[model samples]
Target chain A: MGGDVIDFYFDFASPYAYLAAGRVDGLSQRVGRPVRWRPILLGAVFKISGGQPNLNKPLQGDYLRLDVPRCARLWEIPLHQPLPSPFPSLAASRAFYWLDQVGGEHSPAALARAVFQAHWAEGRDMALPENVLDVAASLGLERDAVEAGIAQSQVKDRLRAETEAAIARGVFGAPFFFIGHEPFWGADRMDQMEDWLQRGGW
Target chain B: MGGDVIDFYFDFASPYAYLAAGRVDGLSQRVGRPVRWRPILLGAVFKISGGQPNLNKPLQGDYLRLDVPRCARLWEIPLHQPLPSPFPSLAASRAFYWLDQVGGEHSPAALARAVFQAHWAEGRDMALPENVLDVAASLGLERDAVEAGIAQSQVKDRLRAETEAAIARGVFGAPFFFIGHEPFWGADRMDQMEDWLQRGGW
Candidate 1:
């Protein structure tokens, strides 16, 4: 809390979070502060905040069609559009929790990327155990570890706690940030994010 | 379009637009550009884009209650908060169209403030016909003229056409600006709005 660190609150299902994740590392280095990734569930945030599920909107399906490709092209990231929304995010959330627990050479960032790719790049459903395992293996993580983590109660509990923390702190959406208690909500605010954190969030 | 003029697409329903409406004069003067008011119905824009009805979102209502006061206090603007949800925007849009019709004094800025205040301060429903007339009367415009304009078929048609033009220009939401062929959305982008309009929108 003291030395210049920005806690980046993220949700895996968020395209904006996916966009910000790719940039946070470089931003952190340039701003001379480290970013701590706090994984939170977006669905819960939306429910409490009264935010609509984008997929449920009248143009739900088409939004990602325009937004995803446009952002991917801008950031030059590879994206695989899922045919059916890549399924429940529970497993992907568990895998990241397990990855976070073990404290291996794998950065949360690597696991995060792999999970995004599982749903977004490979167009694979996250609900499928095989899909989760495939993405885990691809990230050089052992499938056994992921399976054990998913089966454990701690994974679900951890995610619930994270979501609760986000709600308690007034984070109503994904890619929301608290640069020293000031909430900035939206992807377009990244430049302000950089400036905010760079100036120690004045 | 060929001059230093920039089209200001505004919605009486949007508080940010209200903020912009009042401040744009000074912003234009500082940035050395002329801003032309172009009012469009936000309801139509929301229909095509993936935005929810105001009553549908809890945080929106919450933000309206909590954030508006703070924003007005910070920005030193008169924000009347009792306005009905989605305050009768049709007439508000129509009124701006009327202002454009009469070729007004005060540069359409008063109409802009009335629109903002109708929704944010007086709690007037901008979508309501009565509220539009009331706002116009407050601005010293003849009540009959404002109401007569709203009844005009051509004015209504023009309003609809502007909304369609907004959609056609890739505008997905409220408070949009056009710097040449490029369109920027939201009051959040005001800084960027100034930057682009000045630099020929490079």
Candidate 2:
């Protein structure tokens, strides 16, 4: 729980999480803190947290259709809404954990951004194994090993375990962050989170 | 639909709305836009929007308990959690519409701030009619007339009608704002709201 480490939990399907992913790494580096990117299945977290996905709410769903693009434009990130919106993030989450096993300090982060960009930026179907593998290959990771690793029992178990662990630690949403056990939720909270770090928590 | 007007929809019981209420006036003045403060019941808006109050979710409730105080401190506002949390805001909303009937450019705005302070700052029981009347009286409005005005059938109906109007306009949460029909929801969107206003929306 050192001040040098920040824990970031996110899901591939969340637009806000995509937004946070783009900002967290740079902010962490600037603030001289290392980030642990813990990719989780928000669907599972929602179940434990008694929260329903925003996509399931008709009004919220419509609002997000407009909001996501607006936010992407505001943040200066290239985003295109996926054809099949709110697709399963399990495979992508699994890829992350699999990559974490062998990747160095920045490899997992690179893969994380690639996954977010593949789905949200390029509108690629990350739910598809081939698409995920294609993204992994684009990141210069071995394709056969990534394909095999995602399908591995331990990798899938690790993703599940991590999601449950996040729930146990009171993570109920995507783009949830923790700096020394102080929780900051949502992409909108990035500025406040930075301020908290600067002031050493008020 | 003039660029000079910003429509602000809020509920008295919402903590985020309280935060927004504190800042919207100054923002309006700075940006040279007029604010139309429309106080509405979030409960009524939620009924049609298929949404529930955030307090109903245990995890979110816990997060808000801490987040509210943190935000209050960050914004340098006086905030004490209301004695009875999630108190009925009907009387307060009705009072606003009643005040709107006779008040000037800043009357409704001032009353909105006073009501928010009475509940969130002084920890008053805003659910009680007497408390609402007390807040109105404190604003230099007549005591007996203010009490009678809040109870007027038209005042009650205006509050109800405004809430329905807000729903019709696609407002699903408190602290919802609009600049010429470009909708923004949540207090966290305040900065984005200002950006949209400044840039005339992207």
Candidate 3:
């Protein structure tokens, strides 16, 4: 069996990504592949791809408003509604890279999960740096270290580079996965991804 | 079981809709629901919804080029690649409405399937009215009647009105389905649609 790590690209601001975050780990375990969680800024990716968020579109925005919650209920994931206005995903994304770089008692994945839950499940506004820090602190991460790490030029640059790299790699949307060289986009595509992984491509 | 016909909104221009066309009948049979096929022009829908075709976008276009064939393989559907440049879906679409109006020995659904197969399975250029008529003729549909029906102002107006109605009903994409009041979009959402039909929503 090929043991290539599945690269999961996501933005915390995306509710679909939040829904996908809950279940990707289980898929990884089932397929016996380690997941590399890569948080990216969709805003940057969109600027290049000339794409807009579903919430910004007309009919699609309406459909997303309905679909997200229904999917949450069906998937049995707890999700709070009406996310913070101008949902701030930047701070959380930066914090993720910082946590990843720090590599301490808490894995970056845990912080990512906690941040997704705090923002999506508990309706916390991730726009505030303190809110992101608060979620990190809840995970026993050093509050000062996290704040410092996120502010560091290296961490900021890491996020910028990663987002650019994601765009370069043709990732235009959240909850995108790369099982080997094959790319699957959207939370709904997980089933197809699993099938591809198991069948080794048809 | 409450008998409600599933409204399937599609555009012949969309490859995803073509893929959905092959399976929707089977789904309808399995769920004990009749399907009302409604073909709308996506070009009009996109104008109102502020949407662009996946093929027009950057990263998404590349991904779709790869994903379409992969999905065809996974679904075991025979699909010909490199679709006709500027795929003439309008002719086939108009012809479909014409066929529906002049219902005789052949069902409109049969014409839809044949048109999809000719365009997608055989890589026939649907831009030509002759090609669309030829497909209809192969299906035992009267050629001259179909040509005359498509030319009628009433048939043109019917297609226009249907496209307008689709937008009013919030159909922004191809292969959109309505199970009662619940709306599901995309060819990939078939499993969810089936589950909703069988489980009567969660």
Candidate 4:
């Protein structure tokens, strides 16, 4: 458990997850733990958890529009206007697993950051496979391999299994983290997470 | 706008609101603003916002059970086990408005803190009117007048109106704060709210 990596569960469609992605590396370095970047489909997780997108909730939707940018500014992370709709994160998420399987230890994390930046920071349309491939290609991964990798049934199953496994572990939201068996949710919880690591639970 | 007091919107049933109640005073002092403690019915607000208690959601409910106590420990606030069910907060919420109407400037805020502590810290059942009155009486308010105050139609109307007005202001949850027109939600957001007040928005 001492050497255990922090499991970071995220959805590419989530802006909070995007924000968490930007800061998690620094958190990892400070805490002396590697992060296991696990990209899951929130739509799938929400289906079982009876949760929905905050963007579909009444007041919460409006708050997100204001808070996300404010948080980005405060954290010094670049962010553009949100997509007209949530980016269809299926391909991007699948691409992450594929990279994790074939690439080096850090490659998947690098790709995750790139994909999050493309959609959130640069306003690229990640719903398009071409754009997702483009982001992966920018990371120097072969575009054809990424396209093929995402289409694999095994890769699809891995994401499905991962999302279901996250639900089994009581994760219902993006930007969720696990330090050993303890769960921490949301980008806002980074401070608490830091404290948890520093004090080993207060 | 400079002279405007910060508006603190809350419900007694929420542990997060209980946590916020403890900290809001220091926040008010540090920001050089008074806080208008407005007790609200999150149940009514949820009806409009299509939100429900975090304790009613699946995985979220489980997370709250662990997180609340952990937060209480981290914040150095005492917390016993939560009530078997949520504390029915209507009568307590009404008591807050009634106290605000007739008590001294700090009395209602004092009552809010006591009620939160009684329920959350001491494991008292705030669902019972007798318990709420007892807590108020302990604060030097006449018990008979407190009982009469909570039972008054005008006080009932005030609570209803405040809850509706909070909904109108897009408050979907407990521990919502407004600095002028800018809104902040959740106990977790206190730091962000403080930053907003000190920097006057980033």
- Against the reference, the lDDT scores of all candidates come to 0.69, 0.83, 0.84, 0.85
Q: Give one clash count per candidate, in the order shown.
A: 19, 0, 0, 0
lDDT of 2: 0.83
Q: Candidate 1: DockQ?
A: 0.20
TM-score of chain A for the candidates in order shown: 0.86, 0.93, 0.95, 0.95
lDDT per residue (tens digit) for residues B1-202 in model 4: 3446889998889989888888888888898888998988888988887788999886788889878877766777778775335778988988888988886744787888998988888888999999999998898888999899999999999999998898888788888988777888988787777877677764
Instruction: Put down candidate 3 lDDT per residue, A1-202, tens digits, no spaces.
Output: 2358989999988999998999899888998888999999988888887777888876788888778877777777898866433375878888899888877677889889998898889888888899999998998888998888888999999999999988877788888888767789988878777877778764
Task: Note the residue pairs that clash in candidate 4.
Answer: none
Q: Report each candidate's C-alpha RMSD, comma-separated, in the order given.
A: 6.0, 2.1, 2.1, 2.0
- lDDT of the structure predicted as candidate 4: 0.85
Q: Report the error of model 1 at residue B175, Å.
A: 2.7
Query: Model 1 Cα RMSD, Å?
Result: 6.0
By DockQ, the better pick of 2 and 4 is 4
lDDT: worst 10-residue window of model 2 chain B = B75-84
DockQ each:
0.20, 0.63, 0.61, 0.64
lDDT of 3 by residue, B1-202 (tens): 2348989999888889988998898998998889999888889888887787888876787788777776777677788867533374777888888888877777888889898888888888888899999998998878897888888899889999999998887888888988766889998888777876666774
| Cα-lDDT of candidate 1 | 0.69
